[model samples]
Target: MRNFLIDSLGLAGFGAMNYGLYLKFGLADALISAGGLLLLLALAGARAAKRRNESKGAA
Candidate 1:
């Protein structure tokens, strides 16, 4: 569920950035936005993975 949301967000972000590039947005701007989203996605994924591992260890 949460993992799905995180993945979706990441996908959506990429799609948006691609669209921006297609629309001729400056390279630096597009990369910055994409990089920010990637960082956010990475953090969320790491957190979710950590929680899953903890649950498995408890069980």
Candidate 2:
């Protein structure tokens, strides 16, 4: 599930970058968006890890 979430985020990010490129957006805008997506992916991974740990502790 965690891997799936990360993969989905990556795909979305790529699509977003492509769209920005297609629209001829500025480099700074694309870089900022990429950074935002990376942050989101890291957060999602951390959340998933926390949940997994909780379940292990409960078990």
Candidate 3:
């Protein structure tokens, strides 16, 4: 599904970014970056879910 693909891409991007950070900086930097990214992703997903639920309720 489209959502699956998007989620897959997001995970892939996260992995790549984390690896790059680890290589350039270190494990600590990578961990921090991953945590921040996870927080952002969680917020975005929550917002999307809220919008979806509201639209369903309206209909």
TM-score of each: 0.65, 0.65, 0.84
- lDDT digits (tens) for residues 1-59 of candidate 1: 99999979978878976677757977777777778877997899899999999999999
lDDT of 3 by residue, 1-59 (tens): 99999989988988998999999999999999899988998899899999999999999
**lDDT (Cα) of model 1:** 0.83
> What is the per-residue lDDT of model 2 for residues 1-59, given as tens digits with 9 covering 90 to 100?
99999989979879877677647877777777778877998999899999999999999
Looking at model 3, the pairs that clash are none
Candidate 3 stretches greater than 4 Å from native: none
Least accurate stretch of 10 residues (summed lDDT) in model 2? 18-27
- Cand. 2 Cα-lDDT: 0.84
| Cα lDDT listed for each candidate | 0.83, 0.84, 0.95
lDDT winner, 2 or 3: 3
Q: Comparing candidate 1 with candidate 3, which one achieves the higher lDDT?
A: 3
lDDT of 2 at 39: 93
Worst 10 residues of 3 by lDDT: 6-15
List where candidate 2 sits over 4 angstroms from the true fold.
Answer: 1-19
